[model samples]
Target: MDTFTELFGTSPLIWAILGAEAAFWILLFGGLAVRYLLRNRRLSTIMLIGVPVVDLLLLTFTAVDLAGGVEPNFSHLIATIYLGFTIAFGHSLITKTDAWFAHRFADGPAPAKKPKSGPAYVRAAWLEWRRVALAVGIAVVGLLAMQVMVGWAVPSSFAEANEDVIWSMALRLLLIAGIWLVAGPVYATVFKSTPATDTTQRVSPASDTLSNHR
Candidate 1:
């Protein structure tokens, strides 16, 4: 296709991706603003629903296009990146936004919940890993799906002439495997090792008794 044709043809896809990206950031910040600034749980909860709706629409369009053999475009990659950021930084983003909003207008201090440990910590870590794994897994699946679709849809000579570097990696399977198995436990262990405060340190029983007496 000509440059103009390709660009014009992909415009709808681009807009869809942009809409999804907008939905994510808007719902994130908008929901926090409602919860902290407006102090409206009902409204905030309703706004929060938009996040998944956007993701659902994005995924539906992606699957439809791929299943129908549309060649992958840059917008698809942007959507993937958007989803990645949302999954990875979502909680932090919401918490920080809430804290900032509350600091300014909620007339109360931000809630500072301590990190969990033992079973709760393990469960939270597992859930986080699953979220990250799903994001990474989606990228991998999308890559593979594109490869299959392109092979099916495009002429072999045409695809060979315009092969993309993004799909050229042979070690993607290894990368996906590492993301699934290695990334989670390593991150959890490192996170646990780092304390939130440097002023606190463990002391022996004698030192504790002396300090208490003093």
Candidate 2:
């Protein structure tokens, strides 16, 4: 059995690990640039769907290669980090990147709107709190999924296990919560009305974009 160390050289599984890291980063930054250029958040919005799909496919291939040619390490630590990121950034791209752009790029004035926090607001927050609680939970689940998948690959006992289904759902909820958590403040600050001044600050063009998105 050629362990990942022997196949890849003195370093244990370096190529496999590095390859995965590089792929993840490339996809992340690539998506960022893409969303920025497109001037539409939905491209990133679709990343939530596309990323995990790609990751799942990649993981399947990695596992086959690892079993045939490498080792995910005898300890499953790498799997956790690898899979955690796939889920996190995948989720973030979908839910939070728009917020990221909004917060970073917002420099305009908002159109006037009444200040109102209705019951729907409270209800939305209440519903979302449960989702926010799932961020770490989703990460944990993803880590566990990696472990489970690795376990199955070794023994060929792969069951659907309902875990991936659960993860898909949890990751989405986590993404929504995370986007709101970071972007919420940005939304509040960027969109909220400021008193009209004698000196008058007109809306920044970028702010208009942000407001339109909101």
Candidate 3:
């Protein structure tokens, strides 16, 4: 117990967040397994419902830790990011996973392939970037709320540590948002023009041959 506390520090919220993350995946796959393999929709619904409950549990843990005046650490930042991304993207993930499970276990249709290139790909990329933006926004809001709760004072070592941790987290989030924007939207926009160049090159040979014959 002493070692465990030492490893995670005095706050149990870190451990709780870890457990919640593990529980989320377990419940997701377990629910799908029960639904498709065992053909038990009722039980599966119960298990799948438990997935969001796990998120709530993590939120509660974070809130309690902060309320108790625990110093903000990496774990708190992680909790905020995790919650943000999960809230923003969890449903899509669950739907995609369920489709795969259905195909594998229940003889359902195969999942549709994601677009790889062209306008479709660009649109998908933009859509994904929007989701990334939403997630980042949520995370920023969460960090701000935490700061508000803890106040802006640095009268003590804990307050200074908290400020440092929060600043690092904010910077990390900004880096992520910027990278996603460039990689997803900017790259996709550039890639969308490549097909036009390739098509023009392919047609240039035919145009030269026709002119020579004339």
Candidate 4:
């Protein structure tokens, strides 16, 4: 234990953050593989939840270290909450990116496409914008919750390290929202031109009757 502590002694908190980062990717890919490949949603949920549990371990350690009068790095707190956001919101980002790629290049049906022009184009743009808005809203809520947890855990140390943490987080959130908002319009443009194979036009009864008469 002495050697172990010595190795991480200089930056125990950074080590914790590194551990959480590793946990995040492992949980994401592993959970996705189990969820889709094995088709075991229950197990997948467990794996996904386990991602944040890694941070919980770090939190436990940090709290203990603090109690022992050891100074902890503030980045450890940020990394904890950062991983929480990844656990909470990463799936949505992944799903959306997958969908966008599929629509762009896949041979199957184009799900997001609409009529090329006129009111249909406008409507599709509006709907796409709304979807982006919803994602932004979910992300904002996740960040707020994360901030609250950080606020509770390392109120003094975080402030000492960076008094503008709240503003930093806010600006980060805004940058995320901005990216999505810009992507919304690009997605809107892509959806406006429906693929020929994707179109589903119903024949009118009158046309059928006329054709039969002929």
Candidate 5:
């Protein structure tokens, strides 16, 4: 355990890898849940935000290893394959046909008749931007950026000194924070709340108050 912990530390790459694995499990179970319990046609989406992180981690790790650190070994190959599959799988989870089409539109309260529409989402906050493909594009871009950064910053055959490691940690944390900050506003701007009705799509103050009441 101690050795494994040392190998991993809290590097963003590791975090991304961990997140990816967690997302895979979450997605797998989420699918099963939706199928058996949720009844496949339900229009619920899963939040495996970790998918991007994993993809980034894999790219970075591969870069580091190839740059002349430890020669690629069996474990390395295994990881490579794992990350590859995760990226493909994760991508599908975020943007898939069965996810969007099935269930005859789930049991959503229905899209509310709204006053205005913008950026597609704020037009209907009650309805998530998950339906939009652009959000997935954003995630893909972020993941690629992270992957390049890690590859350039740290060489596979190289390990940083304590101070450099600390700096790396700080940078990774800053990135995570930045991504969330940016994503929040984007998502908010895209997802607006409207009136609540089976036909009216929106998340209103009434819903909030009602949930709180419950």
Candidate 6:
């Protein structure tokens, strides 16, 4: 506890962001548990609703912290990136997690696994890249908004202090976006698996000979 405080004491926004992320997971699993294990949909809904509430709290904390002249740092950048991804992907994440929980606790059908290769795999890769693009767009918007807020709220010198960190954050985000695009959709497209080739690889010589004879 002492170590944690010492590391984060100067950055309340960082602490708040961490707390928000922890709370998101807790509410997600807790809501699913209540829904499947306890069979209480109403209570579970309330808990799940709190997931977005956590994001709102974190956003408010960030805005207030910045407005209060807390010079922007890496933590502030993280807070915005976290918010963007959560806003972009939170529902799908919750739905996927809920399916798993339901399968485990409520005898629901198992969730379908993503295809590892072939056309389906390529499609999935493209879909994931789209999500990444959306997330990056949202994060960039958030960084801009915060930058504007800082410029408006504080003196020029104070706002200028944040420019380097803000630019760093933007570059980092772009780097991640570029890497994901190339590794996911671009790679998948370049090395896509064909159904015939996949079937041929799976068929043994004996099976192929027997089928040919038939």
- Best-to-worst TM-score order: 6, 3, 1, 4, 2, 5
Which candidate, 2 or 5, would have the higher TM-score against the true structure?
2
Candidate 4: which stretches are off by over 4 Å?
1-9, 72-74, 77-214
Model 5 Cα lDDT, one tens digit per residue, 1-214: 6886666543444454566677666665565456546565343343334445546766677567545444333234334445544544456555453444333345434333434435444533423333233333343343344445445344343245223432333344346545654464355564543323367667799898999988
Off by over 4 Å in 2: 1-13, 38-50, 69-76, 106-214
The TM-score of predicted model 3 comes to 0.80
lDDT of 1 by residue, 1-214 (tens): 6884465365466678777877888898888788876879899988987877787788778767666756666656555545554655566666667677777777768666546544455556776666666666666556666567667333256355246623533134336647655656556665554444556677999999999998
Writing each residue's lDDT as its tens digit, candidate 4 over 1-214 gives: 7875554456567677777778777886777677666768899789877866775776676556555654434453454455545545556655654455445544434556446665566566666566555645544554455445445433355445345554455456567767766666566566544533546787899999999999
| Candidate 1 ranges with C-alpha deviation above 4 Å | 1-9, 110-134, 148-166, 169-214
Maximum-lDDT candidate: 6
RMSD to the hidden true structure, all candidates: 6.8, 13.8, 5.9, 10.1, 16.3, 4.6
User: Could you give candidate 2's per-residue lDDT for residues 128-180 as a string of tens digits?
Assistant: 44444454565456545555655532222224333343333444545666777
Per-residue lDDT of model 3, residues 4-50, tens digit only: 66656766677787898899899999999999889899999999999
Could you estimate the TM-score for every candidate? 0.56, 0.38, 0.80, 0.42, 0.29, 0.83
Q: What is the lDDT of residue 173 in candidate 2?
A: 46
Better of 1 and 5 by TM-score: 1
- The regions of model 5 sitting more than 4 angstroms off are 1-19, 27-50, 66-68, 94-105, 108-214
Q: Which ten residues in a row have the lowest lDDT in candidate 4?
A: 71-80
Clashes of each: 0, 3, 0, 0, 15, 0
Query: How do the candidates rank by lDDT, highest first?
Result: 6, 3, 1, 4, 2, 5
